[model samples]
Target chain A: MVNKAPLLEIKNLRVHYKVYGGVLKVLDGVNLTVYPGEKVGLVGETGCGKTTTMKTALAILPVPPGVVVGGEILYKGRNLLAMSPRQLSNVRGREMTMIFQDPMAALNPVFNVEQQFTPVLKHAAKNHLSNKEIHAQAVLALQDVALADPERLLQAYPIQLSGGMRQRVCIGMALATRPQLLIADEPGTALDVTIQAQVLRLLNNLVDRLNTSIILITHSLGVVYETVDRLYVMYAGNIVEVAPTRKLFSNPLHPYSQGLMDAVPKLSGGGISQGISGRIPDYSHPPAGCRFHTRCSHVMEICRHQKPPEFEVEEGHKVACYLYGPKNQEAAV
Target chain B: MSEAILEVRDLKKHFVVDHIGTFRRQPVTVRAVDGISFDLQAGETLGLVGESGSGKSTIAYILAGMYRPTQGRIHFRGLDLFSENGKRPLFLKKEIQIVFQDPGSSLNPRRTIAQNLAVPLQIHKPDKNIMRETLRLLELVDLPAIYMYKYPNMLSGGEKQIVAIARALATDPSFMILDEPTSALDVSVQGKVINLLMRLQSDLDLTYLFITHDLSLMRNIATRVAIMYLGKICEISKGSEFFQNPQHPYTQMLLSSIPVVSKDEEKLKPAKMIPTGEIPSPVNIPPGCSFNTRCPKKMDVCFEIDPDFVEISRQHFARCHLFGQTQKQG
Candidate 1:
C-alpha cells in the first residue's frame, strides 16, 4: 500500500559544521514541513544554511566536518537523521531526491547520462527490469524536460553538453525515480536567463504531474517568487519568517524581508535601489536578540537584548521581529 | 543628454592557439571580442551583460586598459589612447580603474585594508597625507575605521569587496569598470554594494561600464545596457526601454527567464525557452548572428550573413534578421 502522510517534516533541526575556528552554527532550529504537491522556497543570502538544510534532508552532508547537532528530519514517518547507513541507501533517492547547485560540478565527467541514471532506476524497480525498458523510461524523462533527441543524448558525457543541457539531464535523472520529495538548491543559478526560465517551467510541470513536493533553496527572491507557493526567509542560519508567497511580497513584516524586497531593482528605470545597511553577521558568534537588529532602521532596545517570538500577524503570515508588537507602530523606510 | 566619456571603435581581441608536436596544424584565433563598438557617457552606468565566456568581461578589460586590443582605437575624454603624438597622457593610467569579480583573490591577504588602499594613493599621489586619505576612502565605502587594521582573511566576502572598491576609488578615477562586482556577494550585501556604487558614481561624477550576468540587478542599476553574445553585441538600448520591449529574441529570453517574486495574479504563463546547444568556440565562430545556434526564432538568413543593427525605435538597437525583415515589411 502507498503510504499517505506528509512527504517530509523537520522539527527544530540544527546542523553545525566544526571548523578549525569553532563550531559554526550553520542551521539553528530550522522547522519545516512539505506536504505532497506543495512547492516551498527557502530564501536567504549565501552561507545562511539554505543549502545545508536541503543537504541534511537527503543526509548528504559529510559527517566528519559537518554534524547534525539536534532535532528530527522525518521522511514518511522515518527519522532520516537516525537512519542507519544501510537503511538510508534505500530512502535517499527513492523517497527523497536532490538537484544540487552548480550543474557542472554536480555531474561526473567520466560517466555518460545513461550510466548515471541506471542505478536509480534499478534501485526503484519492484522486479528486475530489462535494459530496453530502462532506456525507454530514460528517453521519456529527457523528453519531459524538453530535451530533443533523448536517444542520442543518453550517450553523451556531461562535458559534451552545455550547462543548461546538463542541468536538464540532472533534473531528468532525479525525477526518473518519481521521488516523493524534490529538493532543488539553486538549480537555475548557473544557466543563461532564457535557459533558466525553461528549467523553471519544467520543474513547475514536474511538481504538478507527479504530485511531488519540492523545497527550492535560492538566494534570489525572484526565483522563489515564480516557483514557490510559500516562502521561509532565513537570515544568519535562522528562520526569521514564513508566509504565503503573495502575503510575504505584498506585506513583509520582518525588516530583513522588507529590505530584501526594496533591494530588487524595478525594471521601470528607478534610480539606485537601497541595499540592506549591514553585512550578514559572523555565524560563529552571532549577535544577541534579533540578528537583524544590527542593520534594521526601526530597531528597538528590546531587539538588541531579547529575541522576539514568532508572531502570527495574519493568517498564513508569520514574522519574527519586535517592531510588530502590540504597542509599537509598524515602521517603514 | 550626456557627453560621451569613453569611446571604443571596432575593438577586436584575438588569441591564437598553437597545437604543438606531431600533427602540424593550422593556428586557431579565438575571437574573444570581435569588432564591437560603443560609447560610454559621463555620469551614466552602462551595463554589459552576457553569460560565461560571452566576451562581456573581455570588453571590460579592453576598455580598462588591462588588455590591449588586437585592432581598434579607444579614446578617453577625446584623447586617443596609446597615441604617438606625445598624447600618452597620465590620465589614461590614473583615470580608469576596475573592481574585479572575486574579492578573495583580488585582495592581497597578507596586507591590511589600509595598506591596499595606500597602494593606489602611492601610485597616483604619494606626497599627500596617505593615512587620512585612506581612512576617508574606507568611510566612503561604509567600512568602519577599525577595519583598516584587519587583513582580508579576517573580513567577510562583503567586507573584502568594500576594501577592493575603496582601493579602486583611491586614485579618484573618472571612469570605473565593475565586472560582476557583487556576484560573489550575498543578496543582502549585494544590495548594499550596488547602492554604494551608485552613490559614489553620483558624488564623484563618475562613468561606469558595469559587466554582469544578472539581468534583474542590471535592470535595477544600469541606465543603458548592451546584450552580448559570443564576441558580439546582440542588442543595445536605454535600460528601461530594453526591459519593457526587448526587440532581440535573446534579450526577451534572458529577461523572461529570470524567476522573480510575484503576486499570484501577475505570474506569466511559462515561456517557450530557446533550445540548448554548445556555445560554439570563439576560435571558430559561426557566420552571421552568433545567437542563431541557440535562438528559437532563428531564420535562414541568420546562419548565412550577419544582420545590420538598425534603430527599431529611439535609441533601441537589435542585430537580428527577424527585426530587420519586420522593418522592411513595415
Candidate 2:
C-alpha cells in the first residue's frame, strides 16, 4: 500500500508539544496511508492522538504549543509538510475537508445556515459565482445530507436544529467542496443510535457517490466494523496494530487490540469484553519500549526494555509487540 | 410475590413553572410523571426505557424519595411515601438506593473510594465497623482492595462506577434504582458493569428499577420493561414478550431503531415506524395523547381524548386508542 500511489500518505509522522514542564510526544512515528476512495477507521480511546492525527493532516491544528517535529504527509505526490502557506491553504478544505467531533461547538451560533454555507462555497470556488448559483449550491449541500426542506433549513440558525441535524449540516458544509479526502473526527458521537446510523449511512453514501476517501476516527469498534474497511488501532500515541476490520476483530494479534475488542460491549451474547486495565501513559514522559506494555495482558520482559519492531502478521496486517517475534528480542538484545 | 414491594397508583409528579410573563405569574405545569400505575415484585428488575426528558429519571427520583409527587399514591409496604401527614419510612430511605448516570458525579472527588463507600454504612449502620464493610463492598463489585485508599480522581470511569455501585450496596438495600448506570461507560466496561449488576441482583435478591435509553441492553437484563414517552408509559410488558411482539407503535419504533452489528444483517433496519419530529415539550404537552404529535397513526380521537391503558396480553399493557377500542368491543 505504501509503495502504491496513495490519496494521502502519512509517513513516520511525529507531532509533539512544548509544555512548561517538558516536551510531549503526542504522535510518535505514526505511519498510515489511505488509497483513493478508501475508508480507513482510526480507532482509539481518548488522548490516543486519533483527533490530533486528523487535525494535523488537515493543517488546521492549533500550533503554538503544538509542533509537527517530523513527518511526510504526501497527498497526490505533493509533500504537504513541505508545502508553502498558499499551497497548503489551496489543498486544505478544497482538496481535503474536515469535520470536527462536536458539531454544536464547531458551528457559529450568530450565523444562520446560509451564512456558514456561503463562505464554504465561495472558498471552494476558483471564480466568484452569482448569488443565485451560491444559493442553489447551499440548498444542494443541505439536501446532500438529506435535510428536509433545504431552503427552510438554510434560513434557520444552528440553535433551531437538533444535534443530529447540526452534525448533518457540518457534513454538508464539509462536502460542499467535494474534496478528495474527508477527515471525520468522532462525527457521530453526539447523536443517538438511530440518528447516528442515519448520519453514518449518509456519509457512506456521499463517499460512494463522490468517490472520496475518508479517515473516520472513532472509539467504538461497532462503528468501525460498520463504516470502515481497514482499521488502525492506536494505544498511547502509537500505532499498535493495523489491519482490515474483519481480520482485526477475528484475529487480533496485538494484546492491546484484543483488550479493546474485548472491552467493547457487544450486542450478541458473549462474555463481558474485559476493558484495558490502565490509563493511557502520560505523553510528557511516555514509558520506554512498547507504549502499551503497562496495560498489555501478555506483556513480556522484552516489551518493558525494548521497543517492538513492526511485525508483518499476514497480508495487510501488521502488529507492534514483542510477543510477535524474535525481531523484537533481537532489537532488545 | 411477597405482597408487592412497592405499589405506585396514579403516580403524577408535575413541576409548576412560575415564570413571570405578560400575565400574572404564568403557572405552567410540567407533567413529568403523568398518571402512571405499576407494582414492583420483591426481587424483579423493572426496566424503564425512554429517550431524554421522557420523565423516566423524574419517576426514578420520586420513587427513591428525592422528589415529592404532585398527585399520586406511592404505597410501600402498606404505608404512603408522599402523604402530607405521613411519616417518611426509614426502610424507604435505607433499603432503597440509586446508582446515577455519571459515576464521577455520584462519587465525591475529594474522598477516597473507601471513604465514599463508607458514607452509606456510616449513615445507615453506624454501629458496624465502616472500614471492614467498605472492603467487603469493594470486593462485592470486583474492585481490588488496594483501590480503597485511592481518591475518585485516581480511578478510571469503570473503577469509579464500581465504587459507586459498592457505595449503593453498603447499606444492604433490598431495592435499587439504577438510572442509566452503564450509559456513560465504555462498551467493555458497560458489559462488565451489567454482568456485575445481574450477578448482584441474583445473589442479593435485589429489586431493581432500571432506567435506561439503550433498548438492546434492556432486553438482555430486564425481566419486565416499561416504555415511556413524554411523561407517560406507552407500553409495559415482560421483556421477552415486548421484544417478540410490541403492542405500542412507539415501542415498535424504538426496538427497530437499535443498531445491529451482527454481519448477518445488512442495512440498518430503519424503525418500521419513525416517530415524526422531536418529542414535544413536557411543559406544553398536547391534549389527548402526548405522543400523537410524533405518532404516525394518530387519529382525530387520539388528539381529543387521552387514551386509557388496556391489557393486550397477560402482562402486556398499552395506552393506544387501537387497544382501547379492542378492550371495549371484547
Q: What overall lDDT, based on C-alpha atoms, would model 2 receive against the true structure?
A: 0.83
Comparing to the true complex, what docking class would candidate 2 get?
acceptable
Model 1 over residues A1-333: C-alpha lDDT tens digits? Answer: 124467788888988889897988777788887777888999988777888888888888888689999999998788998889879988887777889888989888999988877887888774387899889889998998889999899999999888888999989988998988889989988877666777887888888899888999888888787778889999887788999887889888888998888777554435545678767888788888888889889888999988787777887777888777665654443
Runs in model 1 deviating more than 4 A are: A1-5, A324-333, B18-23, B82-90, B263-281, B323-330
Q: Per-prediction DockQ, in order?
A: 0.51, 0.37
Report the poorest 10 consecutive residues by lDDT, candidate 1 chain B: B262-271
lDDT (C-alpha) at residue A59 in model 2: 83
lDDT of 2 at A71: 82
